[model samples]
Target: MKASEVMADLRRRFPNEPEYLQAVEEVVTSIEDVYNEYPSFEAENLIERLCIPDRIFSFRVSWVDDKGKVHNNMGYRIQHNNAIGPYKGGIRFHASVNQSILKFLAFEQTFKNSLTTLPMGGGKGGSDFSPRGKSDMEIMRFCQAFIAELWRQIGPDTDVPAGDIGVGGREVGYMFGYYKKMAREFTGTFTGKGLDFGGSLIRPEATGYGNCYFLLNMLATRGIDIKGKKVAVSGSGNVATYTTRKLTELGAKVVSMSDSGGSIIKPEGFSEEQLDYIFELKNYYRGRISEVAEKYPDVQYLPGERPWKHVKCDIAMPSATQNELDGDDAQALLDNGVIAVSEGANMPSTPEAIKKFLAAKILYAPGKAANAGGVAVSGLEMAQNSQKLSWSAEEVDDKLKSIMKNIHEQCEKYGKEEGSDFINYVKGANVAGFMKVARAMMAQGVL
Candidate 1:
């Protein structure tokens, strides 16, 4: 049950898939000690089985551009596991999409869904298609083509797909329309659909709000109040804006928000009015973070830099890309007296950064436990669709909060060390999530 021995085999087997290997290593290492305690698990080779996905569907997506130019992109769906429930995860449309990234995302999704206490398995799908700079028509055509191949492998009780990265409401709408047309059945096969359809209320704000709720729970454990706490949040997408919105509502100051180009820094923290402006900028106009600087003369935009370097706050939320915050950024946040870190994005903090946080004994909430809110709401959407009903915004929000609180509790149960008050959330999340999935796999037997 040595972590090194298992990691060596995974590295050998997945030579080119660094992201997937990293994800597997993190979980295996975290649960190795507990895994050893279960001799039956070792005999059944549960870890080895878990490392391999149940199935992977790969196909080519062909679409014509506005100018009638034909384009082809690789699309994939990694259906990792389904012992607990149906396959569930998001579809990321970005230039960085690949087998490695999607595999890592699907692997992480297995645990993230488990943390929600929802009956969802793990799956992820996407393409190397970049939606940025593409016109509305071009994006639609691309999405329709992408779903043409994906429609067959997914269904309401099969693999339920949501949106991620460049795949937003528009993209999801396009894909869902295509799926509905192709399948000739209108169902809750997709989670992030428009509200006019089967989408759940507050689904867009679920992840962000959930992160804060988990953060609040973490703070409560330490008897530290969130009021008057200055926070630094990165990314200008729905996750970032909504996280800022929730933090602001909870009496915390969110001083920074960032994008690929740079970060927008406001020493006095952004207001609800400003967040509205940002929402319109990113969501409606699809503009850059620099545009906020032009609209508001107070905030400064650091070109080609992450907000972590300039952080001066009590909390940090990296809602951007994977490994965006590294060891240096962790040091910067620590130097600025950051007491907690809530990750909104999958693997936002690098292993090095996570090590620093663990060493400093900060209240660090991994995305698996912290960002389960979105999927929790997605799960609610599934239930609503099944029951032919729709819950109110308040109902969905209450459910999401309860799910986040439960995830935090699970982390606390597994994360706390013997005779030590410090909570290792990463270890907690991995062990807790693995136990459920592993038990299910063992009972289901060598599938």
Candidate 2:
């Protein structure tokens, strides 16, 4: 299979779905060489089959607000592939969600799940409903209405939806409650649940902690220690917050964090008390990251900006949304003496940014490998739900670390050149994940 031909065809077919097209192009470019080695896979048109989702469910969700006003939103669930196991992914409630974004996410999730060695197929569901500024009652009503139409298609053993971005613990709980009512059974239909429910311990911190663990492995390959290393982290959501927490615990100095409003730069690094305030501001008060600058005299807030080009650090982690970092940001980070970059958000770095990183020979770990921790823990949550048991925080954390280490090993195996010290983690992750799913698909036969 030629990468250019496949991408050209995809572009013609999905002319408006830029995000999905970009994702497919990246995976195909990485796995093209390895894919050609299997004649049967090419003969069966496996590449085309894998590029497209197994199914897509789109519907209108209408709910009444507290003011007696009705609002309508588009909801979607992209069930990409299930050759490995059940459909598993997150439910994002941001206004930015659409078929293109969700398709890209679901496609990335397929390979990400395969890297975990877990029995999970790729899927993603979300709506264009923004949870920001919405009252609790309004959000609850929306969640119920979302599941009211979607509940019939999902189950504990079928598709288990987790939380992402606008969908947090509160949103997951709301949806789980509605699903329980409709299904007449309390099962693990969703992850990122409240602790009182069937939620697994450390699930919230898994992604951030996992990214840090993966970064440590990357640093170790070059004989570097994380202690006292200056770092810049973007996004103040769950991933960034927990990544900051874990980095602090590892003795790294995190100098910056950001939100959609802007970035907060603390060259002296943030204290535990400051982080707590940030957590409260974003999670409870729904405030912006600029508040951090106002509260602390030492910190500087760059309104309407990201942290990538503003902060100087040894490591950079883009935990924000897709394409937040661009070629200019990549150059800025490289010029500022950044040695490594680990992604905490899906497709946060643009193609140009990724190209520059590869050219610079910096240790760059893509989102699929770096952010798989969140879904890995979600898979564990599924297992716990099936057994009617919850593991201790330490146990879950240990397993998460183990999974991250194994993922790193797989990347090295496929990404490292036979005689070179540099590892192309992007290519490695894509090829490794693709091989697994390709084999499974081949064994299962064409559907």
What TM-score does each of the candidates earn? 0.99, 0.99
lDDT of 1: 0.92
RMSD of 1: 0.9
C-alpha lDDT score of every prediction, in listed order: 0.92, 0.94
Q: What are the per-residue Cα lDDT tens digits for candidate 2 across 1-447?
A: 999999999999889999999899899999998999989998999999999999999999999999999999999999999989989999999989999999999999999999999999999999999998889999999999999999998998889999998999999999999999999999888989988989999999999999999999999999999999999999999999999999989999889999988899887788888888887887678898988889898889999989888878999999989999999999999999999999999999999999999999999999999999999999999999999998999999999999999999999999997778999999999999999999999999998
For residues 1-447, what per-residue lDDT tens digits would candidate 1 score against the true structure? 788999998888889998898888889999999999999998998898888899999999999999999999999999999988899999999989999999999999999998887899999999999999999999999999888888999998899999999988899999999999999999999998999988888999999999999999999999999999999999999899899889988999989999999999987788778888998898888899999889889889999999988859999999988889999999999998999999999999989999999999999999999988889999999999999999999999998888888999999999999999999999999999999999999999888
Runs of candidate 2 exceeding 4 Å displacement: none
Best by lDDT: 2
